[model samples]
Target: MHHRATTSRRTLLTVTAAAAAAAATGATASAHAGASGDRRLHGLISRMSLEEKVGQLFVMRVYGHSATAPDQADADANLKEIGVRTAAELIARYHVGGIIYFSWAHNTREPHQIADLSNGIQRAGLDRPTPVPLLISIDQEHGIVARIGEPATLMPGAMALGAAGSRSDARRAARIAGSELAAMGIRQNYAPVADVNVNPANPVIGVRSFGADPQAVAGLVAAQVRGYQAAGVAATAKHFPGHGDTETDSHYGLPRIGHTRAQWEALDAPPFRAAVAAGIDSIMTAHIVVPALDAAEDPATLSRPILTGILRERLGYDGVVVTDSLGMEGVRTKYGDDRVPVLALKAGCDQLLNPPDLALAWNAVLRAVRSGEISEARLDESILRILRLKAKLGLFRDPYVSHEGVDRAVGTRSHLAAADRIAERTTTLLLNDGGLLPLDRRERPNLLVVGADPASPSGTTGPPTATLATALTELGFTVAALSTGTAPSAARIDEAVAASAGKDAIVVGTYNVSATSTQRTLVSRLAATGVPVVTVAIRNPYDVARLGGQRATLATYSWTDVELRAAARVIAGRARPEGRLPVPVQRADDPTRVLYPVGYGLTY
Candidate 1:
């Protein structure tokens, strides 16, 4: 994420001083290591033909048969062969500099699936003796976006970290996330999205961003970057410039940045700037278009003026520049005229990720170099950065990971325990009327839980009902779980209403954020009946805002196993809701603004 600075003079001075010190230290290391590691890296770059150097900058996917395609049965055999043969041959034949793993094929694989996958791909990269190791990257952003297989430590998304409002909390989350990926032999993470969540309606970046406040988001981004890099995983701050304001998802088509270039400079660029200053190792280009920045191009991914002119020149970002997945419609739909890899590289991207067509990408880059379209110098420029990144990652020394460290890294008991701490800290109480919470399990032993269904599925899990029932049961509350899908199914609502009618206190877990009509109506009905509706926002906090008159809401941010237990602790009066809303919660009529600003939360 190359962010143009909008900073105080004092901060600028501090940054300049830090940069100077880092340069001196880095020069010393490079001078000492140049003979061995640095010399080999330089030698390989010198010996590489233009084709090979260009290949080093291009990272493509191993495509499988389309899941939506019709001839599935026949395609299955071809897909497996495609996975092994395409992967194996890429190393032997193309010697592609890097490879990206798509999570589709290995959905059912075991916990160490990534370990095996990374090993295979790295073996392919090392088939030939390159002085430096090849780069491998994955999209292992936590929450709904995790790409690693089973026993994945699915923590709450960035929004949850925002909810915690603690730098230490975010740092710990990143450390665990980094450890998990590194344990799997994966070294790069396309994560810690620095985009400030300014637009609630943004489909692609809704919960992915930290929050709306630039300062808070910046702090969290910095913390996460340090944690991830400290753990030896290269953390990437993504969607450069910003992707937080658009309503459309760039995955489907080009999303234009309506903000003027200056407006973007002021609002969306702060966190990214903080990230770069924090030494985030890589920046992923967004698929969105900014006409102010690139009037001639629809998407920035294909625009050199934006990528090279602005991101490189104006911002002075020297890190590896990776493009968002090239398989997205944003690039494929518009730039179908030319091969994507060539356009991306010409646009100053150091890596072409998940290239839709590998042979096409390879030949296009090769063809560009042969035809003098892209200079050998430009190719070298990118490879230099790539090699530098590999060296910085310690990959140049030895890309191989120890086979002995498997038991302690991923999905271990300790990692799960850490996940629980993150989950516990992320719970927030958005609303509490007259201290109507902390359902004393000893006092209100016969507790009833209403509104636990797919309609209320937790954002942490991205499924139907939250685990409130299990959490309550664990707390020894005589609990009952019921779903109120769009409208409360008559039977379900009646049962909940009857059960809670005279209970000492009722804890209603309403999936208030974007709830289905039935779920919304059920919540309304329950609220009208005068039961203590401890409405749990298992998803977005805006869900509580949507329940305009329903002021008795609690936001757990997500329904991860960790969050569920934490929410129960809050209900049982064991833990306090020390969190605040990371984003503003607006009233229905005032969609443009928020009724309760970020950082508004109640105490027990």
Candidate 2:
């Protein structure tokens, strides 16, 4: 969709304020910058060459100067030549439209490092005669997935919040996440994934989605949109139509879904509609194929029927539509190098995101324009929308947020407190035997904790661990910590269980990752002992479902410090279990079915 307004609110207000100031000298919106500001912004974007215009549509990856950057100096030089150096050079030479930060190249643990990198990028834009700040974005969807390393704020993933069964809780979580991103000067957040997580076997998007119930997911998606927008950050609802049904990861290969247009409209489009109604600034297309929607074999990124007929026409969403990384295997395998920019433009996408090769993509777009493959009108449309978004973010006229902004807002107690609050509300208990939980204070049953160190040495866990030993200790449970690395060995789980023998109750904590195997054998073995076993799925409840219902379960959906405390509170009866099942729990034997349907949760 093209932008309807080129005149920035800031510029218009500044001009008006300036005129008023000349008459009386008191500051007003018109006097802030005014008509002159609008002209400057417009003129600068208009004066760019076709090459620059093509460049403006290309968004690519830029690794920060942190530990993760490639170490070889020559390779670094090549990256710079490709416009990966300073933000100023990127705009001056390539005129690239935006950037997606991969990871910090060195010591990325400190929040200050991220702030510094963002500041430098913003400064580079200011160096231009007419500054148009880059559309800097990050993948900070909270929970198991986050790009920012330690010493950064991490919240539980969407699944946990969805389980909370409160829209306000989801909004609070988003607000905290957005505030953290905005404090660092980032304007775009590619998050609040609207995918309905119906398939338990889904390799991805389990914890990232709000939940499987259409109405529940829609409500939470709206809250997340409201939270990010309220804090001045652009929120994008992504993988349009849906990516939750597929068993394959688009990064690895293309996944095909048999859903017809009607099926998709009924099952997969509710959250997106809710998100758009809540005013999401952008929508990203998924790479999976729905033959019912588009049979041309093109993914949503290049499918006119999917991107235009469905998204734009049926949904009435006029916001900018961004493509999922063009570099992903889904598009690359079918279209090759030249078709990326060309097909996405034809599909109505306003931005070509995360192209594998920027220079190649630039030429591809330029060639398409010269050969009449893509009209000049199409180019103008995308740039106009990009410019409008920049103005809306107050980036076109003035791109600076003072160091005070960083100091006053980032990591503030208010935001941290909000995270903790959401964490407490989102934890859900999936099973209980003989009212074993909310243990009676008089009994003083011996307690045991059998998971890895859930704390980050700061006495807090993040978006990953839902319950920590220290948090359990605060609940008056005698806690002992056990370490579970990326994947635990069978002996490790057995040893931990053996140590807990003869205890009043057995609590087993396990984390789930897509590629890692779930310990069904270990869980079954423990349940066989019949010693009142309680399993805490500190990652995805789906992890426990793998055990075939042999053990009782609690679904935290994360193991973060805050979530850990929330889970412990639920266990000790300090808090009521309000969260419902966000996604269906499926058993391995019945791989094609669900063991626990959505909305199932136990309460005292």
Candidate 3:
């Protein structure tokens, strides 16, 4: 595997001071390896062509498992968009500095497969005329947002860690995740979401955020940054200036956060400041418009005032500034695909991520530089930062990882046990009325596990119900599982109610109950069967407020197998419900009233 060489304490201290100085001065200074490294980086930059430097700023996505040998489906998609049949061809043509992996894109299949893919891509990048190492990155934020699934040491997500209320847990989980990603030859993790989820109604960032409190979220963000970097992976604090309070999903629409200047500073800026203070390797810009920060309708990704003025000047974060996907509607609504990238570069972004049409965006950037819209000097600033990061990651020294290390490090028994312990700590019992939980195994031997088996952000489903049943069965209960879909039809609810009959106790997993009445109806119908019912909010804690009448309720914050099994253990009295609510759940009937305040939890 690509191991980080140990640095002496004296050298580490000097490097830290240098990095702080670089951030304050906004200079593209190489701090990790001192003056010699700086000379080498500058020498490399001076020798690169404008085309090669421009390519270094883009971290594009390609549809393929292998660099040269893509499946038919991946080949068709790659050719249609990138004008290339394989990742190798695409890299040779565009000379992209980085590539992102997504399970949906078939980029991540298994640990060994991912390691091979990483090696292949790195080889392709090394074969380029200028020969730069590719930064292989993925959004393995765990919980609902994990791209690499199964046997990958899946840990509880940000909110779940928030609920667990332990910085050490957050740090440990991130360290394990980072080490695993590094083992698979992935160098960057777009994780430890720093967005403080103050808005419970936020559709995209609800469970992904650490919590609602800015200071608390800031603490966890810093801890996670330390953890990921400690494991030799670049940690990214994302959706900058904060995407926590917004209601719209940037993937579909441009959401405006109406926080005033003072409100923005107090409510949204703490986590970012904390991240900067922790020396986070990179910060990803949000696509949302905050009128207080910038008067223009442009998203933060395209706003010089936000990206340059606020982040660079005010926050003093000199590390790389990467834009969220340019294909997202939030960034695209204000400008064409061609103009968006140029605007982002001018706005102080160092990397452009996943543009919809790579050829169009790449050509646009090239034209901008040639037409004097974007200065070559300006391009060098980003290139220097990108290269400095690559060097710090030890990518220039050795980008390829050993395939044998994949099995040794990706999913070890010790790592999985740590995940289980962390997941167990995150199971928060919102309500356990009349001591209905810790269902007597002897009395409630025959149980029905039914409810919304919601698909995760990765598009994988069934851990909610299927995994719950398996966990309960392992705990010696005779369990029957019925998956009541997230938006269960009335017929599905009827089938669930029928399945609940004659059962000793009914266990229902609710997913985002506030969004749909059908799940609420399903839980209600199951409860009406006159059997003792236990509800687990497998996605978000807000669901508990909507189903207040339920006798027993727990919040897992995610539906991953780790979380579901944790919840099952809590139900079986194998583990205590130690987690507290990370964010408050307000009453559905009255927005002004708080139903379950933050830090609230029940234990028997």
User: Which number leads on TM-score?
Assistant: 3
Cα lDDT of model 3 by residue, 122-156, tens digit: 87776765667789888999988989987788999
Worst 10 residues of 1 by lDDT: 1-10
Residue-wise C-alpha lDDT for candidate 2, range 1-604, written one tens digit per residue:
0021123334433433333233222135463454444454455557667776787787666654531233366236536646454444555566667777655333134566666666666555444433346777877777766666434556767898888888887787788778777777677889989999877667778788888887888998899999987877889898897998888889888888877777788779999999988978889989888888887878888899989998999899877889998888988878787777788999889989877777778888899998998987688778766766666675654555555777676767777777767777777877775677876434646666565334332223332222455666776766555665435588877776676676665566765633335355555566666666667887678766555433457788866566777777777778887778888777656766777778888887
Off by over 4 Å in 2: 1-44, 66-88, 104-109, 149-152, 439-446, 451-467, 484-490, 512-518, 528-531, 548-551, 591-594
lDDT tens per residue, model 1, 100-183: 655554421444545655655555554543423567777776654666534666676788888888899788888987887777
For candidate 2, give the lDDT: 0.70
The reply for model 1, stretches above 4 Å from the true place, is: 1-39, 49-51, 63-86, 129-132, 149-152, 450-466, 484-516, 548-551
**Candidate closer to the true structure by lDDT (higher is better), 2 or 3:** 3
| Candidate that beats the other on TM-score, 1 or 3, i.e. the better one | 3
Question: Residue 131 of candidate 1: its Cα lDDT?
Answer: 24
Question: Evaluated with lDDT, which candidate comes out highest?
Answer: 3
Off by over 4 Å in 3: 1-33, 457-463
Position 340, candidate 1: lDDT: 76
- Model 1 clash pairs? 1-283, 453-465, 454-464, 454-465, 486-517, 486-518, 486-519, 487-518, 513-543
Q: Model 2: how far is 51 from its true place, Å?
A: 2.1
Q: Write down the RMSD of all candidates, one decimal each.
A: 8.4, 6.0, 4.9
